[model samples]
Target: MTIHRIVCAANRKRFTGQIVLGIRHWDLFMSEALDSEGDPVDQGFVDNRGNFLLRIEAWKVAEAAGQIIRRVGGDDTNGGTLYSENLY
Candidate 1:
């Protein structure tokens, strides 16, 4: 397992975390939530479009899963708000 760095190109913010392996699955665990211009952010934040940025590596995991759905027991207006960085 590797600790990866995720950068939101839209916001220029960064997060440090690892891809956690589960029972035949994988998940993201953000050990360090955010770094906004060198300042630490305690909580999760989204973009103006209400989406989180997923880097290439994370996108690979999601792509391998066939589809990326919201986490279990997570707030569901329908699903999660995550988008691939490559898309933008």
Candidate 2:
């Protein structure tokens, strides 16, 4: 079983709506699933008016039968603020 650890980061945009901070990063990743050659995969995720819905958050997702999944970071609502806040 190949466990994929998806680590995502978030930042406040100057002009935009509200995001849970966690789902935003995942949404970006889903829309841009890349391979080794550095190409576009067309994640096929909808914008939904800027509402990011997480698989785990929704308690439902598509995955293999025995896949070890884990969401390291993303949502910072309940004291889950990002690990690092310095990215330049």
Candidate 3:
């Protein structure tokens, strides 16, 4: 199993999330969950309102992180650019 950390930045707020999945099966899982349209759902964003963290599983951290980066309006250039790294 492999775990990947994905961060979500929204409304000037930032949150830390993670994903866990099998290395071999990540392609199938990611393909189904992500595509050109984006994530299958907005659960990650919704869950960010509380103490929840968006957890996902993928074969590659970069890929999973990419999905998250796209969803949060951060592209390759601005991905993970947190305004405040220390909020907790």
- Among these predictions, the greatest TM-score belongs to 1
Go through the candidates in order and give the clash count of each: 0, 2, 3
Tell me how candidate 3 scores on lDDT. Answer: 0.29
- Give the CA lDDT, 0 to 100, for residue 58 in model 2: 24
Model 2 scores a TM of 0.18
Residues 1-88, candidate 3: write the lDDT tens digits: 4344333322211232333221222245534433343323323221222332332221123355343333332223333322211111
In order, the Cα lDDT scores of the candidates are 0.32, 0.30, 0.29
What ranges in model 2 sit over 4 Å off?
Answer: 1-17, 20-51, 54-57, 62-67, 70-88
> Could you tell me which residue pairs clash in candidate 1?
none
Point out where model 3 deviates above 4 Å: 7-62, 65-70, 78-88
Cα lDDT for residue 48, model 1? 31
RMSD (Å) per prediction: 12.0, 12.7, 13.0
Clashing residue pairs in candidate 3 (N, C-alpha, C atoms within 3 angstroms): 18-55, 19-56, 20-56
> lDDT of candidate 2 vs native?
0.30
Model 1, span 41-84: residue lDDT tens: 22222233434433333444343444344443322323433343
C-alpha TM-score for every candidate: 0.23, 0.18, 0.18
